[model samples]
Target: MTQESATVDPPGDELFARVPTEVSVYEVSPRDGLQNESTLISLEGKRRLINALVAAGLRRIEVTSFVSPKWVPQLADAEELARVLRAPEGITFSALCPNARGLERALSAGLSEIAVFLSASEAHNKANINKTIADTLAVFSEIVPPAREAGLLVRAYVSTVWGCPYEGAVDPARVVKIAEKLLDLGCYQISLGDTIGVGNPRQTREIVRRFLDVMPPERFALHMHDTRGTALANVLTALEMGVRDFDASVGGVGGCPYAPGAAGNLATEDLVFMLQSMGISTGIDLDKLIEAGNVAEQVIGRALPGKVHKAGPFRLRRSPTRAS
Candidate 1:
């Protein structure tokens, strides 16, 4: 095999004994990463970022959201951006649409895959979308079926599955019910989000364990934030539970407008680096992934919170006495 095609085995077999051989990384950088940026990113800049992510071998990317421009002006160019997207073969490009209006916009843009979002907590639901949890689900029920009938793949996000900024310690049962409802509403996959990043490994394990009883691991994905610095640990806990899909942002650049003091999503480079080091294939090039993160950093005009983007990959250092 060519050097680039060859796999790098994990340093120790025992460390990765329970880890899966492959994992699907859903890239949310173009959508979730930029939605909350203080400065507006030009269409050219957004296109450049998406191109870099595709070049890094990301097969699934959330390109943009069709939410009202009044709420998130950073993504006001969603329709225009959609028109300019250049997705190659084997790439699945998706956009988040809050309701029927947003879905109609996505369909008009020629997108066949779309994402819907609601929070597990009532307070977040009301705060985020200005609707109660029940009201939001009602809207989704109206939107999801029509989208599916139009030959679109529908995915749903249940935010604040672990804890809510306004309401602490979310009930696991509530998350399960929300996920079941989403699946019943014709969502092909459901992403459980630690929106405020208050979850730890123990909480993640318990959450996964609860969900696994009602659905297969493939039916669920994890969307974690690094606000508490335990995002990777939570991922490791999920990996051990056989959950293979994860949602990550490039350079960890986005946070919720409703979630006060919340950090960005888990950095894609950090997750890819850990997965690769543990002998798990993500079908993404670590070097190229870092390059994408760098591009995102440049677009945002600041250093990101991702460690790998700043420190680079880990390497063994030779002793001072060794030959130069």
Candidate 2:
């Protein structure tokens, strides 16, 4: 046969025609997932969770946050945790730094990758960090540079990008402007968050498209909550738009402490299952991920919101033979 006739199409070409070959799954369950829990998890429990996530093939993990214990007591052991946690090779560990103090703590703890956060809506910003958007940016301006000078990779999260509980409706233009400031402030990547989980597929598409017009897809990531059950749909929309990075909590174990009535995040297992079934690679093991979810559920002492964790992965079976 001729060379042209000998060539064969790859598997799942139709399913993944519009999807990227590989996507980055940034696991945030260690920090965002447990920040609002009422129960105080011991330092050892937290360490076990992080180690479990690492063993499950997650390369990037947000291990903890450096906020004041008064604000988020769940992560009070941030410094201690950071100091004791072992950073194996090939794994990129990150923590959230809210201000100069948090950055100082993270740097002292020997963390190389840190994340900063600000909200797009003024009302949400005021509620979350007790500052206006401009004030938060000013704080970030001071925080980002020195952190970069310290040879640290800085990532910024813009919360309430879709809608705010206090403000009701947020303007996407304002979000874009805030993102530009973050990029200008030297944030390596910007994760747009639907802090209250009010985004639909249409809104996700529009906001992502506008952002892509100004910045490359590689510079952006989606941190979606499943409050309205649209998180997975939003992920699909972003994937179609060539966006590859996503933030998910294992076992759907997170909620915004500032945004009232917001639900947990899109479960990492569910996202991985959808991606793998479509032939897109996430470098995560589904069974091990489920085990991690179980750990989270046990630690939190409640059933998680992830569908796959409760119902298990979908399977196909053969039909029975006729009795006659």
Candidate 3:
């Protein structure tokens, strides 16, 4: 055998541990990240970005939200975007559906996966969707069955799972209850979102521990914002607890329009870097992910919050030739 063939790859072994070091990264830049931006990306631009992401090996992508154009003008082309989305085989393209109307639109647009959002805190749900938590639950009951009937995979977004900007600290029990309801309503996975980025490792572990009591860790996903710079720390806590699915935006390009003072979701580039450093296998090409972030910045006409986008990945230089 050649010398190179004799050397075993240690990094592959590290990724094989029972605990998943590399979690699935859901790129939401096209949908959630762009929804709140002031600049409008054209239908063609959205398609170009999505195609690029798929080409870069992103299998799960949030393409758009099926909501009122009057409310979110950025995603006004949701139908067209979803219809023309040319994703690779086995690649899942999902959209955020607010209600039955939105679900109908998503079905018409040919999406097989749809995500529904509800807030744990009353004030947040009210501000975000103009409905109380109780009212939102009533809507979910109607929304879920029809979606399942249409042969779509339903994922739920439980927002403000940690601290809410308006309500301060949220009760873990409330988040758990909402998650159970969404799951009972036929959502295969519940994405717990720290809408305002106020959660730290301690709070994240506590909440995740509680959720583990009711649901398997694999059935849950974490969505964090870096408004307070604690998103990666919270992600580490979740990873240590055996949670493996995460939601992130390229270039950290999202914030809550309803939750004032909230920053963007944890950047995909930052998350991938942390996971890969620990010898995890996310199946994502880091360099391509960073390139996607650059495209996002250009589309939004502003700098993204992701540090990696600002600084290139760490590399060591070779020794320079000296005068012999």
Candidate 4:
């Protein structure tokens, strides 16, 4: 472990004015985290991982994607996985639905929540979904309405909001427009993704600033990859801007097959530690989350890139308190 020190600020400092008191951390490890890994995760292995995440107090978990096995071989058993009762009551399990077929699978699997995704870049959109941005929206329009009508909550993911792998930088306004359309299509929330993990704090503030102009921060979440190692910093910037909901993967194990060089999602343990240390509530037990990360590391068969999971939480021993 490395030694570090910080000057403790007085409680309720002015700098904390704009920060949120409580935040929602969305866990995406079982779905996005394991999607692109080279190692194939078995059904039982995935169940154990999900159980660990639930035990760590993650309420919103994306368990799997409803896509075809030909596309994502890792989650070939999405139907069976979806039926498993890993979490207790009130635990929201979501899955990514790419098209009508995927949406049908989600519906048949008895899922109450599903998410649809599209890239902000036309090239990446085409490469990922094999459809232009316009066509992807068209598909969403067709499927999102039916999914909503079926009494399921729908969420939207707008990838490459900051920068793209195929296309360098995306205009924030363009991303906002896509978000608006998805919302109009009945998505209750939108998740802005830094697919290539190329976002900085300044850029995050500016982009989120623009989104706030049109949509309330409560209706959106930030799904950041640690590819450029700025996911946590970018998240801090968002938190300072009153954004609460964030998507994180336990142990930071995820990547995009469509977007080359993209890293895993922000580590769940790191996000929880930072928020809890700053007096913001994430409602996650850091120790148990680290254990969950260990489960992820074992499942992935490699040492992950999560800092807090590797170093453990900061615990200092002091003499017993003296009586007043």
Candidate 5:
């Protein structure tokens, strides 16, 4: 895709004037993508997926999670993935750590970055992590400080910000408060998750507006699932609102194992195709990203939901248009 493929004239161009020149993409395929997979990807296959993502020029990657294997059996090999995956110097590898034990495991595995998460809806929080929103915050008090003191990069996740499967509409004010608490506890960034993919662009923009009132846009990242097929539209709204950080999974492999009826995440190749076509640099090699998506398909033993990977990155080579 190229700028010449699409054009906007005069007043039309004003609508997109706020779009950023470049955005940092936080790759979450290894952790979020694989955790929802029922097939147990071999240790070697996990290594291949991580290497493939790095090969596609992804700088920040979530390698694995330290949650109990009983809950997410697919990621039981978190320690092994951390130990064996030797990413390049500039690459940032992170993992999801649910509690003190998870953090300790990440520390022992020599991971330099880790993430903590809790839901915005009270019911969903209990279902996902077996804790109330208040209890989860208490646990974060225990997790974030020591991790920060040890010089580790800490990120936080606020799930179900847009809508919850159990409780439907969640209060945006509560979401903002959770983000504030995470920031006070030393989290460098917070990824806001639409865990069940029920968000629309209008709601997304309004929710983001409320968040930007109290926090810097750069401190937030959008993690959208495509269950309702509106993830891209919501992401566009976020971009227009001055957000530059995004979370994506290659081949669209993801779902909250706890959130019934949840779908995969926004596809990495699809996202890159949109961003790069708009002349917003993501610093990713799109062709290699498609190949990485293929690696994911192979690891999962089936086709995934990402479109660009299957369709290839090229648009139809149309002949020059003729005016009748």
Candidate 6:
């Protein structure tokens, strides 16, 4: 729909307009969502959750990260998980890699699509990957080309684009510069991450607007955390600005290992529900998406933070109890 047509509201219309019907939600609960959980999920459980996500009509499932087991013990089974997960047809399974070694392990485990991550804020970058922002980009120079040479589709992540937990109030210009470098290094898509959930609609709009000036929104993905409970709202802002791709976690199952007390990524169930309710086509079954959230919750042995995970999908009301 045209932007003007989309903005037109009849009397008593809902506040948030329905998303355009073509947006795609990429589920990352199995990988980004679970990586920072203090609770370790068993190998079989991870596999089952990923399989369930695929069954729920999610085509893009980030499988796991190939980081050092010593660093991220929760994902110690990365290679094994990658080796054993059933690759259903028409599904794209991706793994996150930090450097050449990580990419090497991912490639050996048969990942054709891989993601490398860096932060737009220097302090958060050093805290996250223990390197300067420039040094990290230099590492990508070594990591991205070889992955591309091996026929791997390389996706890059730029974290702390909105605000950093340590550094705080990151400049949009800094985020834009880092993003351009990643794009220049041949990243197919740059996942813009709000690392600590500090972004509001205004900040989100500003960052996305500046970035879109240099790169098409199609080559970008928004990875938001609900730390301040603004993830979905930030998502709405990006959507209004014509961003169509987003990163969400089933049941909101992730946090930064470095950013303490930070919430996980935006919940996939919530995002899908919002999209579907707006008549936007996500190509996912809301019921099945909740099932995937349940699977993640069950594996983690706790209650999920997603609202839909507790209240369930919206449905037509039944008549009041008549069994008196």
Q: Which candidate tops lDDT?
A: 1
Among all windows of 10 consecutive residues in model 6, the one with the lowest summed lDDT is 12-21
Model 1 C-alpha lDDT per residue in residues 162-255, reported as the tens digit of each score = 8999988899998999899999999999999999888899999899999999999989999999998999999999998888999999898887
Which should have the higher lDDT, number 1 or number 6? 1
lDDT of 6 by residue, 1-324 (tens): 576577655663344453355788888888888877788889999988998899889998899889889988888999899999867777889998988889879988997799999888888888888999889999999989888889988888888888888877899988788878887888888889988888899888898889889887888999989988899899988887778899999998887777877777889988888888877788898899899988998998988899887889977898898787
Rank ordering of all candidates by lDDT, starting from the highest: 1, 5, 2, 4, 3, 6
Measured over all alpha carbons after superposition, the RMSD of each candidate to the real structure, in angstroms, is 6.7, 5.5, 6.4, 5.2, 4.7, 4.8
Tens digit per residue, CA lDDT, model 4, 1-324:
233455565475564578899999999999999988877888889999999988888899999999889999988999999987544788899999989999989998998899999999998898888999999999999999999999989999999898988779899999989999999999999999998888999999999999899989999999998887898899988988889999999998887787778767788998899999989987788999999999988988999989999999987878599678
Global lDDT of each candidate: 0.92, 0.90, 0.87, 0.90, 0.91, 0.86
Better of 2 and 3 by TM-score: 2
Residue-pair clashes, model 5: 0
What TM-score would every model get versus the actual structure? 0.93, 0.92, 0.92, 0.92, 0.93, 0.92
Clash counts for all predictions: 0, 0, 1, 0, 0, 1
Q: Model 3 clash tally?
A: 1
Candidate 1: residue pairs that collide: none
Q: Predict model 1's lDDT versus the native.
A: 0.92
The predicted structure with the larger TM-score, 4 or 5, is: 5
Kindly report which residue stretches of model 2 are placed more than 4 angstroms away from their true locations once superposed.
1-17, 316-324
Cα lDDT for residue 102, model 3? Answer: 98
Q: By the TM-score metric, which is better: model 1 or model 2?
A: 1
For model 2, give the 10-residue run with minimal summed lDDT. Answer: 9-18
User: Model 2: per-residue lDDT, tens digit, 2-72?
Assistant: 76686766665464366788999999999999998999999988988888899889999999999899988
